[model samples]
Target: MHPALVEEFKSVDAVIASDARTAGVDAFALSLLKVERQARRFVTYLVFQYPCFGRSDVPALRKTLSDSKKVYFEGILRGFDALYPQPLEALIGAEYAHLKARVDEAELHRNKLFHGQLTEESLSRAQLLEFVVDMRRWCELLCDAGQQELGYAGFGSSSFTKSPELTMSASFRIQMQGLADYDAFIKTVLRRPQGQQAQ
Candidate 1:
């Protein structure tokens, strides 16, 4: 819902679509969709639990999972390249580089938080809140990116739809309860005063 998040979603959508079109395959679009979905599931878990944990603590966990996902996706791309070596070769190279950079950034953040001895006081609550918002926005952007890529892959306007099947996955549904728990925790935290003494 944040303006910055909205802008980021738009940017990711553009990138995904552009990348897919460049690769010229439905498989790439599908794989990106799966990656986006998984990322969303992880982020939603983090955001929902933001209140109970410190910012420094969450980044390490997130970074670890993100790094794993990046590796999985890269391998998937390589497999796709092996199957369709010509049209997708060049596109895979560029996309792999971009994805690797993102994974590296995530690792850097994780290291800063877990290994570099950062403290929660180093970042204000508002800043941390913004980070949560950004993470959610990134998930949305990744989804949009998949859609855009599908379009570029020549899926046609008819492929675009708002069906439950398109918008929701079983994995997403299974994680919804966990996300709800996280949201409840955040609400409880927000209701309390920042410096009020605990009973």
Candidate 2:
């Protein structure tokens, strides 16, 4: 999985566990919210890790990130399609729709959970933990896909710090060649969350 995603996952996991222990059922709603928040952050991190712009576009990207206003999951998905549509498609092929649907379902649950509309029919501590597990598995699937399809090593791999090179498909490599410092950026990205070990 992407290091940033993993970092956010572990951070939220610890908080949710602590809250569940102390607040019990009261924490279920807020815990799910936190999970949703972290899920959005993870999606953002995953999207941005790919090079989707030319050399002159870094400033625009930086400004976008610098703006503190929130961009919801839908907006993030649109921006990704507008910028780096092909990489994701090539990385996951026909499964893109399934991935989007999964995210959509999560977002729906988040909305219902937030509005306090979810009760015994749809919300519970076990369900919340199950959602967390599902997300973790989703991240792992994406990581595995990227490792195989793009040659980007996943976290905990022996070669995690290595840059994607000849191992990547030629077509994909050509697509990314136009982006400046892509290799260097990827090397750094792959080696991230260095000293912060997951508990």
Candidate 3:
């Protein structure tokens, strides 16, 4: 792992794990806040990862749309979708096809978190734990996928494990393969209808 990626992993994972113990409303609220943060970084990472961004004439995309934009996160996500076209899971693997749908669901949650009030809602420790795990999993998966899809081969798999004080520890690992899947995977990420990026 490069020092910079290691640093980013610690910073993002900590926010996801920090409120895993509040056990109720606090956990739910904090998890929402932290996941929002993680998702923002995740979107930004993918945009910068785009092959076109490194071009000398092209400028990096802004993470935000505008100061008055009501839905900051979802708007940025939409912008990426317009540019990338294919599902991000295409970078990870076929088994993760549902990951795109999950991303959509999470987007809805993000909107609610920002616009709606959370008062008088029923939440449990189990639910809180689920949120914590989801946020961490999403971030970890993206980190691994980013490297495998855009980075040099042979760096090995990217993984991160988080263990709350006494609770069962959770971990995720993405081992990137080569050659056999390379052509197919790149086709998906580039949204190559005929072995070329959609124009």
Candidate 4:
């Protein structure tokens, strides 16, 4: 995905996740679904954002993403390493498989979700937050890798550091494109929890 699209995904994911987090503990199952949906949509966006995806695959990819279908999802995840610069190959090669495994493990929850087999209490709030934080970290790592591929900016030790924090404000704004604002948005989304994770 282009750097802009990657950033766009981050903004939208935070917004959606924040909204879902507003639900009381009674709806934690739904909260899991919301995060799962965002992750699915994110991978779909990456596929469509690819310069060649529009040739005919965009719609099918969108469908797969919308439905959270794992089989075809694997296809969309492919070739990401190819888009990066040669130097980035060394960086991404080791991590790409690991990222895929993380995504797959999360997506695997969808089946239990669909069959009404997953209990609301299956995981604690803290555990759910960890899943999201992990997924967000995955997203950030990919975006940083994408940036490295294009040589758009210098590498920073703490790029997209917000992935570890689970709390999100309902009124948070999306900062598109400008480097400073984008950086701030990341900080805001990732701000450390005052006490417990999530609102």
* Highest-scoring model, lDDT: 2
The order of the candidates by TM-score, greatest first, is 2, 3, 4, 1
TM accuracy, model 3: 0.46
Clashing pairs in 4: none
Worst 10 residues of 4 by lDDT: 162-171
lDDT of each: 0.36, 0.45, 0.41, 0.40
User: What is candidate 1's lDDT per residue for 31-112, written digit by digit as tens?
Assistant: 3343434434433332323233344445544444344422333333332232222323243344544554544343344345
What RMSD, rounded to one decimal, does every model reach?
Answer: 17.8, 10.6, 13.3, 16.4
Clashing pairs in 2: none
Query: 1 in model 4: Cα distance from truth in Å?
Result: 16
Q: Which residue pairs in model 1 clash with each other?
A: 17-148, 17-149, 48-182
Which stretches of model 4 miss by more than 4 angstroms? 1-71, 79-98, 119-121, 151-199
Candidate 2 lDDT, 1-199, residue by residue in tens = 5674465356556656676553334333343444344333333333334445433554554454435243444443343343333544455556667655655566676666557766436555666555555555555565666556444423333221223443322333223432344333333332223454211
Better by lDDT, candidate 3 or 1: 3
The runs of at least 3 residues in candidate 1 whose Cα sits more than 4 Å from the true structure, single-residue gaps closed, are: 1-107, 119-121, 151-199
Q: Tell me how many clashing residue pairs each candidate has.
A: 3, 0, 0, 0
